[model samples]
Target: MFAFVMRRLAVAIPTLLLLIVFSFILMHLAPGGPFSLERELPPQVLANLNAKYGLDDPLWLQIWNYLTGIVLHFDFGPSFVYPDRSVNDLIAAGFPVTLTYGTLRARFKTR
Candidate 1:
């Protein structure tokens, strides 16, 4: 059991890391950014905003910062579209609804 658990952990860690890396890449590659829906601000204001969020850093550095935040703090960081709420907060808030929906679907399917 110990050896089996250890082997699973070894496989799981790399799979999780790859999933994170791919998701990050896909997110960045998609058109539009967090501020895209907002009204145009001055260039100085935009630059300042980017700098404050470390969005101005090189992509690799930004990815490193994000990964460090996740690994060290269990933080997925703030929502890009909802600046006031962190990703964790949003997930917590939505989980109940998700659970309910899944439960109902399964119940109906089995009926």
Candidate 2:
């Protein structure tokens, strides 16, 4: 039983890492960036915004930083859409509603 659990964990860890890396890559490859706006911002301002979020870093470095932040500090950093909030803060705020809906759905599931 212990060996089985360990084997599953070994596979799961790489799977989770691949998922995170692929999602990050896909998001960056999309058309518009988080800072894109109808009216163009000054170059300096755009550079500052990118630097602030570590988006100016090389893609590999960004991924490393993101993974380390999660593994070591459990930090999800800040939300690009909401300058005032961290990703963790947003998740916490919505978690209660999510839990409520999830519980209700499970209780009423057709199966």
Q: Highest lDDT: which candidate? A: 2
* TM-scores vs. true structure, each candidate: 0.78, 0.87
Task: Give per-residue lDDT, candidate 2, residue 35.
Answer: 87
Q: What lDDT would candidate 1 get against the real structure? A: 0.88
Model 2 stretches with alpha carbons more than 4 Å out: 1-4
Poorly placed runs, candidate 1 (over 4 Å): 97-111
Q: What is candidate 2's lDDT per residue for 15-45, written digit by digit as tens?
A: 9989999999999999978888577788899
Clashes in each model (backbone N, CA, C under 3 Å)? 0, 0
Clashing pairs in 2: none
> What lDDT does candidate 2 reach at residue 4?
100
lDDT over C-alpha atoms for residue 80 of model 2: 82
**Count of backbone collisions within predicted model 1:** 0
Model 1 superposed RMSD (Cα) = 2.6
Candidate models: Cα lDDT each: 0.88, 0.93
Report each candidate's C-alpha RMSD, comma-separated, in the order given: 2.6, 1.7
